[model samples]
Target chain A: MSEELDTGFFADWLRAAATAIDREAAHLTELDSPIGDADHGSNLQRGFTAVQTALAKEPQETPGALLLFTGRQLISTVGGASGPLYGTLLRRTGKALGDAAAVPLPELAAALRGAADAVAQLGGAAPGDATMLDALYPALDALDAGSAPGDAFPAAARAAAEGAEATVPMQARKGRASYLGERSVGHEDPGAASTALLFEALATAYGEGA
Target chain B: MAGGEQVGIVLVSHSSEVADSAAQLARELGGGEAAPVVGAGGAAGGGTGTSSERIAEAAHAVDSGAGVALLADLGSAVLTVKSLLAEGDQLPEPARLVDAPLVEGAIAAAVTASGGADLDAVAAAAEEAYQYRKV
Candidate 1:
């Protein structure tokens, strides 16, 4: 099988992301109900719908534009810590994409790394903060450590899932969950769960037995 | 308020789902005021997939005639917008971004933009809030 990251695939990736979030929005909200605002599902659903609308209307000329547009859509539509943190990650990563509509696997890995780094900086937290970084950071690290996308993606997904689950034992220190203190311990971090969903979407799209 | 004009708000986040939801909440919270929200973010992986191109794309989306305020989530993204401005990038004039607590900054910026405040003022408020959140 040929391995290439093209514009069509990139567009499909956004669609996949939207679909994944929509499918899991309810679950995310359910998790949040226990330890944070119970609006995770509603929040992500509305934001992705806006992204779908924005992308459909403008139809980016390049893959970079597609990613950038997606990022911008999230930033413009979403609020809360996830809004800015996620927005910053995409915006910075989109900026890194430049004019190339298609990228190699290595390049894609690098781009993912750039995005994860931006998000980490924005949150001011690390992998164990019971935040999305717990999932995202490990994924990037795996990719940076020379794992292939097919291999790296699933590994990242597993890592993310584990990371989200791990949040169950840890206290929150970032975002709204931080307000809950010890109460935040039992519940899975909503952002990490969402991050896991993102990886699952990608894994389904690109990491399926490649 | 220009007799009930629509305020163009720029939304920034990491994922499409999160950004979309945040924008919807903003609209719902905005009540009767019509808010035209725009969005941007890093790729889904959590870091910025690209930088200049995405900011430029978002900048083009802004309406120059209406007030536009940018709200972002993370540190580098704020820096990305700053870099875009520093480079004399091709973006709508009279636009600014808020680099503060993501939700608070966004709500404040949207409110100010919908009313009498210009994009600069809204952005300033958001930025100030962002600084406060860091501490």
Candidate 2:
């Protein structure tokens, strides 16, 4: 098997993400009800559904194209902070991938780091702000620690899940949740939960490849 | 209006009514022939969210080649506009995102654009609105 992932792998990864988000949408929204607008689950579901439909309608030739199109779909379909934040993550990562048909593990990791950083920059939310960065940064760290491309996804997924759980005690410093001040504590961050789902989807897709 | 082409302004908000009213007020403040102001607000089906597609359409609608200055209500609105601008070839050049209070910033930006101010000047005017104090 190739050491790098092609467009097919990218497609599978998105499909897995959509399915996982669909299954967990209610849980995500439930988490949001306390601190956020209570629409994280439905917003992501709509965005990912649009992504799925777009990919099915017009298959992209390269992984970069696939991710870029997916990001656009999310941005247009989802109507919240997550849409732009996640869309920027995917779009920036895709742009960093630079038209590559297949991306090596190291390149993918670097791309993901760039994507996460872009999300942070766009939202102006740092670690401990009770946002997706809590999960995303840990996932990136785990990926960075992985010596092989195949080793990264599973580790990242595990780290992301733990990170999402970690957000429960944090106080939001950005977004609508921030308006709650101290009241935001005790609730798991919906963004972090959705981000964990994304990593989980990545792990599932890569595990299948292995 | 007596100078070069006016910069365009796009107001992004989660509520369609807020965006529309804000735009109307800004237009009135800038007088007739103010640079075109477009309101891109609300989700596809409406009710409290921002649509990037709507934002893109608004941007295109307001683009007069002088450039565009964007004012957003909240976090997601800002992020969406930034994402749209990040699309390399899709949006016009000289586009910029101003970090400022939405209503005030839009009004300030509209007045500046109406005078045919350049992109930077219009953006600076919007940003300066953050310093306005009534007390």
Candidate 3:
């Protein structure tokens, strides 16, 4: 594949994300049932499906445009805090692309970093807080440390998975789970789990090849 | 900037009924339709969830150039309003997320805005409501 990614590549990744979210919606909801509102799965599934539908109707021309459009859809459709948080993630990353026709992998890396930072700032949490940052930060860290895109993606996916798993034992420090105090431990964070899924979807998208 | 014009109020809640009811009650206490008061509640498709789009729309609708003050209930409601504020240009210019209780804050904010208070004064009234003794 080319070093630079186009709108089609991201659209593919988002479609893969939607499918994966649908398949794993039950598990996501179950994870949330323990420490969250138990609506993460449904909300994300609905948001991604909306993205899929919108992408089909009016395909965005550039990578930034596609992500920006997707972000707005999620913000409008998903509802709840997840909507704004996820929307900001995509929109911030997309905005960093700056209407480039195709974005290089390095650019994507930087964008994801900015996106994660934006999420942290917006959510008022950090990597160990057991939010999506747990998965996202690790994935980006792995991506930055790797040499090849292929190796980086699988590594990132693995790192995200491990990060999500690590959250199981962490005491919640933010969001609704924090309200649970000590009881929040032992349950894997649903947002972290979903972040892992997002990385997995990215890996799958890259593996499909143009 | 304009103090003579009443500040607008937008009540955000997890449920449509909750926000509307608060707005209704606050209106009664606020001298009946003295200022623009809007209830932006629930997800876009209805049901549970705080819709940023809905809140933004409500804020814009109630805005009278005097500035809009937002009061939200519960977790996501506060987060959503903050997210909108961070996004820049989404909310009406000079909009503020007032830190206060949902019902009580809305009541105080509405009363203050209805009396033609400026945006800061309206927000202050809402925040001050938290200090009232319920017992």
Candidate 4:
């Protein structure tokens, strides 16, 4: 079994995250149907599916490569606003991982911060935009606040969930949902939902891998 | 039930490329050597692709008594699979519809399919394995 901090476990974590996305893709689409293109789930499903396929074929040698390849898959396979935003997040984080064979806690934290910043750069949205950034931003904030990796993950997960829920009342400021104006206010953001799942998978991984 | 013998897992997707991606994952995770994950997908339109029927026919032709699992992406691809299977007088194995996380479900299904288990078992595992968690 791989430890939470082990290089092997990072691969497992990415696979697990892929699984979670697969499971929730339709639900996310359902949430978006009312306010957006109704393809959020499908879009993400396709992207992550590509990531899984690519990773399986080549099997990245390092955690950084895993994140980089996964991010590239999303950018290529997925269309719409979510693709680039999510793509930048992973790519930037992968870049942050540098050339290290394995990442320590501090490096991982820095990578996450890099990911969050990249997301903001790509999406041009802040913490309250009811986008994936909403959940991801808070999660990174929580992570940066400094707790054990085990403790920080759960906190980040919780923050993400809250951020997703917070989208319920805010006006959409970006993405297809933004086109809806007030109509988008009541609907949950699909990107945010998937974002929440990423954190959730992370939280669960603390024990499974840790 | 594929006549209760060696079964092939059928994968359908909106595009041939997407379906192939699913096949790639299965090949990696499941089929080590002995068993292979059978795959099919529509090109562009759901029902138009010959790949879906050809793959199923190939599987049946190889071993008529074998069971084949059907996994469809969404849209008309499902109907195409149904028509192809109906012609063979072979009802699809307990099938799964995976729209979101398309790759994950396909990979999981392929892994289990090639793991030497029945279609029902593979589908169940694939479906259950997709649950999103918050830790």
Candidate 5:
């Protein structure tokens, strides 16, 4: 918590993301089947695997470069809206990190906040839109709110999970789910569910010294 | 933008076949003298999804200094194009994602751009198709 997250840390985070995405891919697809095209899990699984492969092949010198590379990989490999949406989140956050060798946790969270805002703008979505932003916002909001810096990741992970579950009762107003209109209610948004997994990966990676 | 070479046109779809068909239709409507038209479709690994790489390539392929007008089939397709545009990757000085129906908008944009329309005109032409009704 006191140290900055370096390239290795970012690498570990993405690797965890890849593993988590693979583990939960089927569940994600199940969530999407009702409201979306039922491709979220497969799409993210492929994208994160590509990121994992890229990390193994070429090492980026800094956290920024690593995240940028990961973002580009996701954008190119993952199809559908998640490609661009998640791509923008990572790429923009990486860009904001600005070639730094390491970033403190608070700074990383701040960069993500800004990037999440950019994603919201790109998607024309707000907090209640039943999208990834639902999970992202609450998690980021919880990440730096307390005195115990070491507690941040766990708190964020829980907040993200809760945020995702909160989407179950809300009608989607963004992404493929929105096409279902009122019928979108009563199901967890796949994007939000995946977003919870992302935060969980981040927490685990940070705990593992990523 | 009046050199008459035409602004480039790109049709994006989840399936390669649909994207290609849309481009072909737009070109046919232009009487074969329209701007460079291309299809950007499918994920990199050959599946049903939108690819920014394909989109960026098509935009690059058709760009002739007059900018490019891009149309997308649905959900993720539109988002993919928007992300590419936001990347600002030297994409023909200007590449725009027009908000309009894919097929109708592509034809209208193709014809207008083939007439040496500027980027704004091409995009507006595409959006104008939103008002078109054939019911």
Candidate 6:
């Protein structure tokens, strides 16, 4: 199989992400109820559903275009902190991808690194902040260490899942949960969980295709 | 007056009602000749959320050649505005995201803008509101 990713790969990746978010919506909301507003799942589901609909209605010819459109959709549709953070991730990564019709594994890794940095910059949250960065930074690190895109995704997904779990004991330093101070401890961060789901979807899509 | 025009203000919040109310309060506090105030809040369709598109639209609507000062409430509101600003081309020159308490910052910015203050002055006014003590 080719190691490069095309627009079709991104479309499938987004579809998989939508499905996974839908499936885990309730669990994500449950995770958020304690520390957050309990709307993470619904917000993501709504955003991803809009992304799915937009892709179906007018599909883009290039991966960058597809992801840019997806980011815009999420920014407009999703409410709360995740919308902008996730939107910035996809949009900045899409911008880094530029106009290339297909991107190789190494290029995609660089784009993901840029995306993770953009998310951190936008949210002002670093790794271990009990936020999405907790999961996203590790996923990016794993991807950076991998040899190829298709093979790297599973490892990245595993790292993201572990990173999300690691947030269970962290005190939030940003976002609404931070308002809770030390009380935010002991609850799994909803944003981190959703971010892990995003990596998992990527792994699932690439793994099945591979 | 820095550029012969009043600086504009955009109020961002997760709730549209809160944004509109804040804008109204700021306008009242600033009195007549208040710089144009735009409320960018909630989802585009409605309900609780912040929309970058809406914020951009508001920034454009209020741009009077002087620049804009954005006052945001909550985490997502700030993130969305910052992401929009990072995009570079979407906002006019001198557009700034003021890191301050939303209501107080909006009021202070509005009052400053109404006096034909420059973007920097309005942003500073908003930032100054951060130190407001309510005893």
Weakest 10 consecutive residues of candidate 3 chain A by summed lDDT: A145-154
Tens digit per residue, CA lDDT, model 4, A111-182: 988778766755567877788887888887888775577777788889999989888998988766788888
Q: Which stretches of candidate 4 lie over 4 Å from their true place?
A: A1-4, B1-135
Residue lDDT tens for model 6, B1-135: 745698989999989999989998999998678788878988777888777788989999999899999998878888888877877877888799998899999999999999988888899999999798998
Note the residue pairs that clash in candidate 6: none
Listed in order, each prediction's TM-score against the native is: 0.63, 0.95, 0.94, 0.59, 0.95, 0.94
Listed models, DockQ each:
0.07, 0.83, 0.69, 0.02, 0.77, 0.73
Against the hidden true structure, what lDDT does model 2 obtain?
0.89
- Model 2: how far is B35 from its true place, Å? 2.8
- In model 5, the clashing pairs are A9-A210
* Local distance difference test scores for all models: 0.68, 0.89, 0.88, 0.67, 0.87, 0.88
Find the 10 residues in a row with the least total lDDT in model 5 chain A: A143-152
Better of 1 and 6 by DockQ: 6
lDDT of 4: 0.67
DockQ of model 6 vs. true complex: 0.73
Tens digits of lDDT, candidate 4, B8-74: 6656665666776777776787656424555565532243332333445534542323455566664
The reply for model 1, stretches above 4 Å from the true place, is A207-210, B1-135
User: Model 3: runs farther than 4 Å from truth?
Assistant: B1-4, B133-135
lDDT, candidate 3, A148-176, per-residue tens? 66778889999999999999999999888
The deviation in Å at residue B22 for candidate 1 is: 22
- What value does the lDDT take at residue B120 in candidate 2? 88
* Model with the higher DockQ, candidate 3 or 6: 6
Give the Cα RMSD of candidate 5. Answer: 1.7
lDDT of 3 by residue, B1-135 (tens): 344577899999999999999998888889854777789998878888788888999999988788999999876788789878977878988899999999999989988899888889999999999899979
Candidate achieving higher TM-score, 1 or 6: 6
